[model samples]
Target: MKRQLVLVALTICAVLPVAQAQKVGETVATPFQGFAHSAKGSQLRDQVNDLVALVRAKRLSDAERKAIELQEKFEASFDRKMRQYSFQSKEEYLEFKQSAPEQFEWIDWGYKETLQMKAFIAADKREFPTALSILATIEKIAPASAGTAAERGYILNQLGQPENALAAYKKALSLSTRYQSQRPFQAAALRGIGFALIELSKLDEAEAVFNDSLKIEPANKVALNELAYIRDLRAKR
Candidate 1:
């Protein structure tokens, strides 16, 4: 039960806007909103209904051009939203180059964390390759790319590819000695390895990895929750 709750928390924390439309709360103002939509908008509703059917079918027969076009639209939306944080955040980002030199070099402050959150959602949705692709782009730019590698491995484990996931986790571990000095991302890598081990069903190993992560980030809620769940599961067994 604890583990289930942990997963539920993770699901909520990791997931982005799973609902079809981007905006939520206040009002969509976009006519058709899920099942609550009006039957009067049948013409508009038909397209949504078709999308639902296609999603249920687990495949899209869209042509290559359409696929690319949709991907671009999604990417544009994601980028646009990433920059739409609080005014304070926008100001901080603008001043990133002048202040906080170490972190500023890393493609804006919250960029990596945002991508990590997005990847987590993708992993929960079983969109492994797409998640990896995002991580890969990050890897190409960040020197501390090993953390993303570990995350990718966890996603692989969730996809039932434990061997590959383990390999990726090991690669992340190997990065420890490679870094010239202690880096912030090392903590993230450790946490990722812990998550990968959990998904791989290596409980003992996962606990050790979580301990390592805690050594770096004692206040990490996800790691703390995960470790608690693992302890609960072990006690149950």
Candidate 2:
């Protein structure tokens, strides 16, 4: 009887692991999932278009405007994520794997920094608190981010915290977004400064800054609109 009991115990132990093998479903981030649930590339593309359309529409009421602004701000970050399974700059990136392969996760996360800044600006324009939250998140992601402080400054300026905003923008402007000259990218940093000046209610200074952005990017809609708007305001006077 003791021998029989031992056999049964061993059998039960052997089966226990299998019984416990049922993995609990991993909880996925449901962010923006309500817009569309399919993870298919085409589906996501469609959803993004829909989102852009909603953002661009001028028909929104004040409350709707606020909501759309918040959504668009969060989206700016998504534009920068260069999805890949390896580092962006192969030469500089591969050195990490050779020296510290254990720490190296082979994933190319490229250029999304600027996108985050734009997103934070969008969100903050709608709701100040949300922008603050996004800024904190950017700081955590890249402590020494070239554009992080600039983005924070923009947000603070919008929130009526001009002193803090100035500090943030100064920090950001000092940090470099180093790369080859490009219309869209070059305009971003300049635009940030221009808008920060706007927040400070320095209209003349802001107009000049926008002009700088336009010089680098003649087709930049933001700078054009802002310059035109300022001129219109002046014309009315």
Query: Considering every candidate listed, which one attains the maximal lDDT?
Result: 1
Q: What is the C-alpha lDDT of each candidate?
A: 0.48, 0.43
Q: Write the per-residue lDDT of candidate 2 for residues 151-211, one digit (tens) a residue.
A: 5665565567766865665555454343121111335556666666655668798798789
For candidate 2, give the lDDT: 0.43
TM-score of 2: 0.43
TM-score of each: 0.44, 0.43
Which ten-residue region of model 2 has the weakest summed lDDT? 1-10
Tens digits of lDDT, candidate 1, 139-171: 554334445666766666667776787787677
36: Cα error in model 2, Å: 31
Error of 2 at 115 (Å): 11
Top candidate (TM-score): 1
